[model samples]
Target chain A: MATIKEVAELAGVTPTTVSNVLRDRGRVGTATRERVLNAVAAKGYRPNLNARALVERRAPTLALMLGCITNPFYPEFTLQTNNAARRHGRFLLVCNTDYEPDGGSGFLAEVAGSLSDGVLVANTGSLQVDELKSIQATGTPVVISVWEFPDVDPGIPCVAFDSHKAGYIATDHLLDLGHSRIGALVGSEKNGIHGGRYKGFCDALRARKVKHLKTDARFGTDSYQGGFDAALDLLTSTPDLTAIFVSNDLPALGALNAAASLGFNVPEDLSIVGITNIELTSQSRPALTTVAIPTAEMAEKSVDLLIKLASNDPDAPAMVRTADPVLIKRASTAAPKSRATK
Target chain B: MATIKEVAELAGVTPTTVSNVLRDRGRVGTATRERVLNAVAAKGYRPNLNARALVERRAPTLALMLGCITNPFYPEFTLQTNNAARRHGRFLLVCNTDYEPDGGSGFLAEVAGSLSDGVLVANTGSLQVDELKSIQATGTPVVISVWEFPDVDPGIPCVAFDSHKAGYIATDHLLDLGHSRIGALVGSEKNGIHGGRYKGFCDALRARKVKHLKTDARFGTDSYQGGFDAALDLLTSTPDLTAIFVSNDLPALGALNAAASLGFNVPEDLSIVGITNIELTSQSRPALTTVAIPTAEMAEKSVDLLIKLASNDPDAPAMVRTADPVLIKRASTAAPKSRATK
Candidate 1:
């Protein structure tokens, strides 16, 4: 509970001298520095972090605003961001918005009020541009991850994967396997990625001359349970469908389970593909053939960009780095059976 | 970047008066308060958070320390903890330790030097007691989650699940199903939960008069690959074993897949049970029968306890709260076939 003034008084030096010694900045005589250090130790002094942040004009911390921690995808992102933050000698404060609108707004407010040097905002599909702008208005540099707002001012940087391309690749793969009737197990349309991926799917089908591509699109929760429910509904509604493209790995896993329980053999009677090749997908039975986004790379690059912005270098170009998604073909995808080929 | 003095001058008040208004403490005339608020709005003055934290003598944020975010279990815990923290008007800063000997000590130093009110530490499996003590000495109240240091001072509160009981329940259930030649697929011995669970399994076998209890334990990474390797080793060492109890769900799933690939039928030829009943367990090929911990409840209660301690309540008792593990009997466990049953 010792104050900087108290430490200064004990060291027989001005507060500025004590501050400089603590920060390892501005020169202080060796003897004076030793006296300050001894006084600090003697008084059990803890540096006043808030006062230090004000003097340095930097919080030396970053905020990572995630959509939901439970979403498996985020842990990888968190690890990468933390590692990158450490490389720059900065700390990260994580906030989970839980995909709730109110929670997202409240979190934005709290983080904007905190002394965070920058923010890496990973939208959970629901972002209000105005809300984001207000936070940026506080002079905290922000790097948007996963989801991007098209209308965001050029000043805001974004690091994302090409969800539309991912969707196109997944669907095109199924089409190449000679399956004409494919179903889409898309997530909630409220999600920006979901919408983009769905649009991509539609575009691929249209370009392939596959008329009346029976769409079994349904909106459900963004979870395995939601995927299970959606799969069941899709199968019941479009029993002739031979292949399915899910929005994410979790739901794709759920679809696989649903197929098994319904007595359909994976890759023989039905084919499934998912996005975000999470670790579980590789470990899953009949390993998922999905698009693997470079989660670590995205996090690392986002942090690097945020740090550059925080350094107050106006010449740093505003960037939108998009890593291409790699299609990992595993045991889950195979040629459609002859009976369903036409 | 208007300073507090500038805002005060605009509001025609002393800097101290403006600070009090910002803190929402001390009596101020209603008209003066409105004037200060209007000045803050007009000048777009954002209070320096570090200065505010210093003045308040408490940072309105909590730190969450975990082993690794890549582990699905930690994210689930984080989700619940974040929700609970939000309900109590607090923010969380999550840090990963990667289960090293340093055990998040480096992260703790950064947090201790930041605007954090308290810390919730978990999964410091390899860290010695003294290392944790050093963190506590920094004057931040810490609530150890998921792991318990029995030798440490009892005054340090901990929220832990009874791993031994969970082990006993899982192994005992397999025993009651008439499986005698049970093999244990435990985690690294360095992990307290792994050791505790192994001990409990051993005790259960002794009580049941079960012989040839193959303890094919392995020390490796705490991950699915580790479990898969352990399972392969266990199968090679004890080909006659009828059932297995894994320390965690991820590894249990890995073991299940390994058994399947080895052409062993689940529950018919071998039964598998795991702890932490994670989401993947239920979604696995054959839903895993495992022990379920009340993660959200534990997080909520721990935060409640920390809030009380932070309020400077001398009467608050240091306590250990345990949540009972429930046996979620699923399709993964059953009586071994007559040929395998002893």
Candidate 2:
């Protein structure tokens, strides 16, 4: 209800000085700044960010396009990204693309350059690379973050971690427990979104000269129920398995419950490991063993890179590599009971 | 990168006509509208939302201040709110105020009537009512959504739900199943955020003439770990208790796992009932039985109320009440074993 003119009149300063004081731009004396702030408080004058954004040719927020917020992983990623954006005095406009009919094409078209200054695509697996490239072409900086494979470039500025290594670490943890008869439950197809992790699982088996039959692996949807059904089918058909390596944690949690329902005692009858140690991993029964990826680092770096790109910084690199994933040995894994007893 | 002028020139129409077509306002011939849309697509012109907002004196976004985005409940609430806001052609600016020292006072000050046209306060329990009133006084519509106690108004526009009824139904379910030794786990103090639910629980016991003691109730934080710790303590202290009434779903989940860790089989050794049937309730082992709150309805009503208030509609009611909570019976609750055997 209060205007800048009233605040300026009360503070005994020009409107430009009030603007500078509010925006924290230009050199105003400390006393002048305090007076202006006090006047603003007294009048309850709120700055119009939309007008400022128009004059500055920059929006005050960055858009984060995520597949699904309720999936648990995106919430963690969204929180970190929200905090990182806040540190820069910017807000995060989160767009859930899972419910979109065109897989967010319409959302990207309307939001790429208007509602937000930059766009951060958190779910690159489902979104097309060409769609991201087209958005980048519109001069609204676009950054693909949490990209699974470091080797595969989307031809856009992105932050990537070693997915292959993440898979390798989770599988190696299972192997270290002398689990010769192993099974694999991949959330995605053999060469779909989780290809790198599945590849890493195979390499871990090959490195130890362990034979993996065609029936030893199952590929299905990348979700908890997917993991549950796949694990149920795999365990029922191959009851001799001592360990199972799951590509993602959500499905692995489902598999854990599925295993329990099937009368299998975890860490005694079977050992299971998962990638990406989300918060729920620690809360589940037996405390899932998993590989902890650099979720926070990736989110922070993605925001940093998007800001740089939006500012037209030529020094912004095409790819930002984060720390490698490491194994967190929780209670869900142990040596095979037959070998332990022997 | 293209401007409206270029699109107008290509469409053989004035810039004003182009604007009318793009905004779906005023009158334009169907053939002319198609031509303008074709030109817009061909030229890749993006209407600046900030400029449009400045001209209309209404920002194209709404600010949603939530306690934490990482909390599973917030994500579900946020997704529904986002979809509802989208239907109104507005974007959502989510602010996670859990990390803030003042619990979002600063967020409210900067975001209200500036970056966003209206503000939706999702977590009213922890926020100060006076702070909300101050924002409302500034000519910005502020809606307090998901208010637990419908009887107590915060002197602002809000959407209310029957928390007392939710608690009563959950307690009644247990009482009907022949469980007399029921312990209560409150996610807050006796008169804190969950007070309404606790009261319902007490009233339910009194109506049935079932004796309850101060030692039978434990008050603590509203989270999984909070529920876990309290349940562990309660179960250890009162091993004869055959059922538990939890104030919220998240804490109830933690209590369920805690019971498992203590070697108590759910529904067989103890029946547990929680308010709020969140998605995880069905996903958890034994599929927790809970009272289903009208989450989606509340979110939609809150957004609708905020929009109406922003438009200065005189007929907008002070309070909007959603549908009542209902019981969702699942594997987690059953009659006491002693009664079942008889």
Candidate 3:
């Protein structure tokens, strides 16, 4: 067994240089790097990485959990968050929760002891409180995005979109377009954020003195297919409805397809407003009207939150950061056509 | 210092139970688990993760490097590969190169000495050879997906699609549809696989005795916006071409949008064929006719290869596994109609 000093002496470098090269910290010239590596091998220098890691109290990584990677909106979110993580000199461990109860739990169990310093649940309504607690008990900090635990206080930080405000804006836009009859495409109860969005939708209608129809609100998974099915269900059950406000953009695209299939022209026969404003919204046949949740800004803010959680006072009061949502007027919304002659 | 035997004695469990709890291995009874944890904490037992990791000769993690995470094609790839990795009890560390030279180098440098057991470069045309070599020298196995070093062999394993065959198939599809004037959209040269695909494009035209007009082929980055600009350039410069074959789906999508903005109806006015039938292809305004590279199959195969490289044989000969591509006929392509009389 040899010491760091011995390896450095043999490699013709200072102990600090050898340590830095071993840690891969500072810039070491290629030649110097090779010499240090060779000397480390020759000297059988095996540093206790676990001991070092315990002392450092960080893993230079962050865990990001999303609903599903294939959902176009998530790809944008992932790229931005990953870029932000890299800029902060950290790597991102992305987990696809598939919005399943088991998906989040199984992944948490898998990474129990070996997790990075902090976790960022980038998607809303994916993780249950118990699942999050399992992760939190491991001593890794958790910062949730978009959705918060409604019933249980998980005692963690959060970055959220003003979902209720977005919902009101979307509904109000349709209302201004002379659409008195509106339908809601809401996700399941599992998604905590949808509660606020749905509430806002109802509140907007109440404010306008419009009666709320239970049949107008359809709940399902957060997917394009889900949105498509919800739209079909709503259109068939509530024939008088002239507008629909979808919770997210992926399903909103599905609703657009549904409208096309149902022999109705978007904006002319039916108006659609969605949230998230993903890239495809602009390129869709009718071009979707959406509420833009600035994913890049959210990712940046969430990364900043994770850094603070990892480095600052561990007992600091949990902070909730809110990102404003903007309404992007596109080709999809308009006043419904006058009723056909009876 | 507390030994495993001492901790187990106080917890009323076997020493193996204490060790398993410390290693975060196979499940133990809840009561036993709690007792073991409490005893370890009370007795101040600290197992060395470095010693365990060294003895295991691997970490239960994989490094997956992609050109960009925002590309819709990669989200599908990442999800499938990540699922496969999870099933095998390994997690993935995702790295986004962003098609920049420094991005890959900085990441490789950052993760030095603390790398996962295996690496998967999931995108092509992004990183240079030196960047890959720097990662390879870390003593962890490297497996490049859909890209390889052209000038310098990085002496690593690879999984690639037959891009040449895919190019020929896409071009041949257009030729069989009675189109003589066809244009091509080639991605950047930095993507190692593009060269083969481009060569195949030329060879197909040559086989058909179509004149190899230098103006017919165009190169650009493999992105929707990149494809958009390239299509705009080609459509503006070449007025008589009936169809275009794009090397990737992202750019092909751009081509679709560009054609729409230029007032050309897809399939009816300008038949377009793309590669990598991404999830959005089927849902696009005109369903895209694409060369479907079985990304899921590729991911599964690559994961298996990585497992082997990480375990069974560190010294095994570097192997290249090729996945075949298929042509998916969709609404975006059709026979060119004879010109309407002015």
Candidate 4:
């Protein structure tokens, strides 16, 4: 409740000296600085941040917009980004878009209008290219995470992982186990990542010279329900399938549940592999065998890139930080039975 | 970006009229408003949000601060709160505290200076009652979620669930299943919710005339690894235990995995029940039989309460929203084997 004038008077310093102390800049003697700090602490004087932002044209805060909060994947990214930001003494303002295209745009617009020094857009599958471009033009440096825009040039720094490679690695692991008949429980292909994963799955099958069954492909929601429904459909349609590759860990978990409900033993009747290798994947019934994407590493690197961009460094290139998709073979995957192959 | 004057001149309206149209306020003619809107759209005029906020002395943004972004529980809460905020056409800013006592206070101070219209403080176990009161004194309406202050009343609103009842329900379910030797895998007692749940667990055992063994208690992180370690310790120390009630689903999941790795059959050997039946719980190997807390509903209602409190509504009481914790009986829990009793 104490005012800046009161602190200045108590410290025997001018209001300008008090302001300089708060900003941690300008020429001031060490004794004077100590006296100003002590007086400010004694009086409990809080700086007026809005007025300061208006004068300085900087908020010292960054905005991180995520597609969905319930997905657990975004949180992994946020956790790392937040820590990195804090290390640089910056604040991160997070917002969840809920995977709505209009909502993503709306949130981006709001972030542009706020006191954020920069914006970190992550997994905004629903946002159109034009909307992204317009937001980028708002003078706020943006770092896009996980997903990439084809039209976005090197000017827009992007932090992405190889989703296509992730899909291939997971499927290849299952196939290497001598499981020939494989089904893919994928998310909606309307988004780029899901589409990329689907493409990779097809490419892997074609490369292996296996009979690629169109009926084996099942599309569902981006959630567990989607995975559950897709698994049910795939199982009912292709009863001979020996392995299944899901697009993400969430759906993979759903598949695990659906498989259990259907009285099918995992790895024994049907092998399952997923991407993202979320925390729950390890804790699940049969620990999920997944393609581990380095979410935290990606987040940390993206913040560094964005910080460089915000500092007006032109040398900072659009970084695509892709981690090697390591196959975490667990109890969920195994070799196909000779009797089932025939 | 075109200035307000340019748009106003082109639209044949005064700058004040243009400002009113931009703010969606004042009694302006429909035709004039349309013309201003068209000119603004054609010229690509963006109202300087910083300037507007400076004039209004309000940021027109709400901030939600959590313990950590990696915790999926916070994200789940954020998703629902965001949906509600979006419906009301308000922007949300999220910040993560990382559950550090000093760091949490620093984040709160930073948020307090950010000029947010309101704040929703979901403290991790790190925050004390006095720190929360100090934050509330900033005149910014705060809605405390997950944790409750014991003594301080800063005229701020709060939204909390009955964690004790949740604990009681989970423990009672295991007891009702004829499991006498129950081990409790709880979070640190320093955490408000964990303490409440622990008390409830003790009270349930007392009501059932069962001897609650203090040696069966273990304290550690609120993660899967923590649960795994705790379960391992408890199992070794209390070999006669037939059931375990975990504080949260994440740790409960770890316990499940530890049980499997230790060659113990769930239900037949060791029955388990967890709180916060998160999405991963139901999707786990045996499908976790736990208590389901209405996280999304609580998030929505919390934001609604905060909004009301911010509007200076005297009708808003110091409310605590209690959602019924439903017993989701799954394969994880069953009657103990006759051999265990013998």
Candidate 5:
């Protein structure tokens, strides 16, 4: 906790000279710089970042507002953003909006442009565009880190990935495996947050001229239990289906387990695929076949853009489109038994 | 981005009066306070928390240094701590040390006493006690949020849960089911971070007069793949074991899948028990029967203790012991087939 004054006093130099030596700025004699360095090392002088932030008119951290921390995907996104921020010599201030009563409006009001230089909103589905814009109006840069739909701009700065492509890849993989009877498990309403992915599923089926009946799809909450119950109900009602396409990974893992519980040998009796190849997809029993969304790329790009916007860089894009989702074929999908028998 | 001076000028008051009215301090007439408030709302002035922190010499955030954010346990722990910090009107600055080249020594040196008011170290195993003490010596409060061993103090302010009891409860659950032929899977070295839990398992076995063979145990990394590989090996070698006690939930989950892969029906062929009932344990098929550690209680206590220490409260205890670990009986355990037939 040695102050700059103490170090300056010990080094027999002015406080500004000590600051110059520490920040590697301004001209100081080599001997004077050495003296300041020795004094800093001897006294264990660490510069106060908050004090420096005030002097520079820049906060030392970026605030990342996430809806739910325990949702599995957010942790991965947060970790990537945290590392990306650190690489830029900044710390990440994580604001979990799920715990906030007003869903983080209070937090945004308090910290925007004051305690934090920029804000990154991860769960854009739960946040309003006007709220983010209002914070942006206060001159704190706000970037939507995970906009699921790239085709429709959210009217705020965002990093978007092709959710429709992710769904298409997952469904097309099952179709390529020669499965005509495929069920869809949407993690939200038909036109909710996961609408793009659901649309892709329908498009992929239509492209192949496969008839997707009304009873072939079930919509529910976007969670493990949601996937489990929906899959259980779907499979029980439509027992002849050869494959299932789930909108999200959490529920897909649930479908995987639910398939096991119902004595349906995965990829043999029934094929299953999910979008967003989260870490759990690979670790599951059958090693889920999922379409890998560019989670890390989107996270890093979002942080980079937020930092640029905060610095008033003219080159910062309003919407950054990341790499397309790719198919990650694993043990969960295979050719239908009818084809195998032929 | 409106300044306090602008609000003061519009309200027809001195800057000091405006400040006092805004902070609700000093004597001010009701009419004057109303004028100041109206002007503040009209001007959209938000206080710069960094400047206020500088004036008060108190940072507005607490730093939580965790090893891995993606780990199921850490997210749960981080969420609880985030919620607790929010309740105190302080933001949570999460530092993921696993990505740090110096393993967070540099992050600690930079933010400990400057940017964050206090540091809460969640992953205590990899961090050195001397490093934590050094930060504490610099006038920043450092609290170990998840000290596994309560009997042995880590020489820093900490919140500890009974890791030993957590192990005991998990092992005792298996013993109660008449599974004498039990194997052990330690997620760390036999005498490493999970030693307390491993010891509890041994004690539980000894209490029941059940002999535990050295060959019936395996030690490995505390991850899903680690548990999967180790359990696959353990079950292959010690096929007679009717039950297994895993030191941690993540590894236990791996073991559950490993057993399933090996064609063993959980609770029927092999009753498995794990410590720390993470969210995944309940979501897994048939669910995992594990000991539930007081994760939230420990997190809240740690944040409270750190806040108290930051305020230099004399009543702050050196070490706080949280509520004992309890057994959460799920679907993962049952009586051995031998005992059931008898």
Candidate 6:
């Protein structure tokens, strides 16, 4: 119920100063801006929307699409992306593409006309990139995250994690543990970004002169159940393997569960490592050892790119930005026990 | 990039039928509506926003504010809400209130002018209801979730889980296992909605004629670390307790970790139960025993109410809709063993 005049009075500033601060128009000193913001918060002042629209033309709104919102990795990604987008002065419109046939193409078709100034698309499942293109075709800018465009349309910019290096590092860590027979839980989807990790795993084996055994790997969905089944199969079918590199943490946790069910203690009998160290990884039973994707970095860069593209000419170099990954050591990983222990 | 004409052509219907189906207008048969929707998806048809805006006086958009987007309990809620809103012909705009200084008051200040037709507020922290009131004062309808409108304004409708029942059930389960000496980890915020659970826990204990121990409960932020620290403190200070009821699942997982580090075994030495059956509970060290709230149902009803309110009168009965909770028996809970067995 507080007015601009009351906020101005509380901050000891003129009403014009308060108005200017609210509109982000006039050059206000940092201290004065902070004071005005504090007073606004204390008074719980909301500017009249109609008046705001007249003052601030073209409401700057951006839509963010998470193709698989159910994936544990996305909630954090969305939190960071939403925060970053807000910091850049854009109100975010989030859409969950889960359960949508053709990876949200239907919803996009339904609402694409009213979408904000730009769109940020995350989790570019196989069917998503084209849907994004259709959105862009509607004259809105689109920023793709967590995947390569794979096409030379130069239609949109993208920001993604370095999954290839993630795979290499996880393999290196297991190799350093003095394990020659290592298994991997390859992603169920052949087109998944996790395939980068599989590639890296294969290269690391080649570099270390460790023979790659195709039979030592199992492929399934990127779910805990899939990981559980894959790990169970890998451990049972390839009994000599001492360490396992999982595609992502969800499956890694599943693999750990499989190890437990099979009477094999983690780190003591088998070493497991995963990628995308989601929040759950740190709190999992044994606390999974995994590769941590720089999701926040990707989020910020993608939002920045989309915002920049929205403001400038349509042809603002549609570049791709990549963020590095980190290795987090937790209890699930340790030097494998003596070869005889297996 | 498929056109409305293309969808109509594919579905063997006139473009008006396709348009009517898209806009949820006119008397369209169910079978015809499905055929048009299928054609729309197959053709990837996106309606033109400017044309639709000119056709319909109101721009049917709904804004959903999540006061705590990082709570692990919200992603699924958001997904369900977004889908339901879409089904009601409303585009959902989501905002995360986590990092906002005034619990989303600041963000509301900036975009309050450009927000959608109606507002759906969830997981409201302290400063939110007033902000919602301020928003409603803009002649906008607002639907609150998970909190009482602390004021006498009779402000808006709310849909919340039956937390009291959850608390009572979790406690009664533990008591059924003959756990006379039980501890609890309550949420830190005195005004938090989770307080309902604490009240229920007490009522159940009192009903069983068990004297409540004030010192047996610890309060902390609803997070894993908070639960861990509180449970650790409780275990170190009150070692005789055989059961613990945590207000939320994140903290319950933390409590499990605390018991493990304290050299006590779960289900055998101690039992722990948590609320908000998050996905991690099933995958936790010992899958967590939890009170499963009907989040999807709450989401469906809240969105339905919000859309209806947006279309109907704002004063159309500010009803409180509460969904029931279910108990999920997981590995983290079990009857305590006799000292003789150990």
On DockQ, the candidate that comes out on top is: 2
Task: Output the better candidate (5/6) by DockQ.
Answer: 5
lDDT of 6 by residue, A89-201 (tens): 77777777766655677666554454466777886664456667767776677888665323334355777566778889999999987888899887754445667778888
TM-score of each: 0.87, 0.98, 0.84, 0.87, 0.95, 0.86
Model 4 regions lying over 4 Å from their true place? A2-36, A99-101, A148-156, A202-211, A319-323, A339-342, B6-40, B99-101, B148-156, B190-192, B219-221, B314-316, B337-342
Q: After best superposition, candidate 6 residue A133: deviation in angstroms?
A: 2.7
Candidate 1 residues lying further than 4 Å off, grouped into runs, are: A1-47, A99-101, A148-155, A190-192, A212-214, A219-221, A339-342, B1-47, B99-103, B148-155, B212-216, B219-221, B339-342
TM-score of chain B of each: 0.84, 0.97, 0.82, 0.88, 0.95, 0.83
Model 6 chain B: ten consecutive residues of lowest lDDT: B146-155
Candidates in descending DockQ order: 2, 5, 1, 4, 6, 3
Model 5 residue runs over 4 Å out of place are A8-38, B8-38
Deviation (Å) of A154 in candidate 2: 1.6
**Preferred candidate (DockQ higher): 2 or 5:** 2
lDDT, candidate 4, equals: 0.78
- Name the lDDT of candidate 2: 0.91
Interface alpha-carbon RMSD, every candidate? 2.4, 1.2, 4.6, 2.3, 1.1, 4.3
Q: Per-residue lDDT for A80-108 in model 1, tens only?
A: 88888877767778888864457677677
Q: What are the DockQ scores of the candidates, in order?
A: 0.58, 0.79, 0.34, 0.56, 0.76, 0.39
RMSD of 4: 3.8
**lDDT tens per residue, model 2, B46-87:** 888888888888888898999898878999999999999988
Residue B311 accuracy (lDDT) in model 6:
74
lDDT of each: 0.78, 0.91, 0.76, 0.78, 0.90, 0.77
Cα error, residue B240 of model 3, in Å, equals 3.4
**lDDT (Cα, tens digit) per residue for candidate 6, span B128-231:** 56677777776567777554322223456777566788889999998887778889899755445567788778888999998778899887648889999999
Q: Candidate 2's residue-wise lDDT over A1-80, tens digit each?
A: 88899999999999999999988899999999999999999998888888888788888899999998999999999999
lDDT (Cα, tens digit) per residue for candidate 1, span B1-342? 678889999999999999889778899999999999999888777776666677777776887888888888888888888888877777887878773346666667557655688878766655555655665676677777665333344346677667778888998999889888887777766455577777778888889887643355555535898888888888877788889888788899999998988888898888999998787788898999998877777788778777776776686556656667889999999998985545
State which docking tier applies to candidate 2. Answer: medium
